[model samples]
Target: MLASLYKNNHGTIAEYKRIFSSSPAEVWNVLTNNENLKLWMDHLEITDLRKGGNIQFHFHDDLGTVEEITITDFEEGRVLEFEWGKDFVRFEIRPEEEGTQLLLKQVLTEITDHTPKDLAGWHVCLFHFADVVNNEKNHYPENEWEKWYEKYREIMK
Candidate 1:
């Protein structure tokens, strides 16, 4: 599904919600654990699990460098929020009858040209997250981003 976008006096906000057929702990594991993380977003790795901790966006192959974004808020099993460029990306988890519900809110400071790409990236990553949690044996959908990118471009327009 396309993330719902809203405009504010300051900028834009993109919100996405997904329900996973797993416990809250399971969903939290996929979000914070680098083992499942690298499969979906190759560049992201959690360096710590505290408010003052950092999430590294690794440029491992080329520069061997990483961009460290500080964690703004955290509650071990419920909420995780961090800086994303000039904005904030927050993930909230809640228990559901079936499993867990994940709510992602991207607090955008501005609607830049790169917004759609980031939105689409998150969209595709969530799909992979679901598959990972469900233990799908099929290969990762490497080509899925292009389709989502197009949708986000239109949505962001």
Candidate 2:
């Protein structure tokens, strides 16, 4: 599903929610574990899994750019929040009666030409994340993302 974008004191927030038919612990492991993370979001690597630690963001381009994103908040098996460029991205996991609820929020200080693209990217990534939680092979659906990007562009307008 597409993330809902709203205004907040911090600026804007893009909130995405997913329900997985897996235990919270299981989902948490897939979310944080480097090996599991590689299956979905290979660009991110948790260099230090703690608040005030770092999460490395890699851009596999000719320049091999890597950014050290600081972990602003962390709660084992519960919450993870980290720096995302000028903004921040947070993940909250909770055990639900059906299984687990994963909440992803991207806090944006300002909306620019790149905002919709980023939102679409996160939407697609979350879909892949669900696949990982379900023990399915991760695959990037570029066509799906393109569809979402158009939707997001309309929404942003």
Which candidate leads in lDDT?
Answer: 2
The C-alpha TM-scores of every prediction are 0.91, 0.95
* lDDT values, one for every candidate: 0.87, 0.92
Q: Total backbone clashes of model 1?
A: 0
After superposing candidate 2, which stretches have Cα over 4 Å from the reference? 138-140
- lDDT agreement of model 1 with the native: 0.87
- Compared with the true structure, the alpha-carbon lDDT of candidate 2 equals 0.92
What RMSD does each model have against the real structure?
1.6, 1.3
Q: What TM-score does model 1 achieve against the real structure?
A: 0.91
Measured by TM-score, the strongest candidate is 2
Name the lDDT value of residue 138 in candidate 1: 53
* Residue-level error in angstroms, candidate 2, position 88: 0.4
Candidate 2 lDDT for residue 52? 99
Q: What is the lDDT of residue 99 in candidate 2?
A: 98
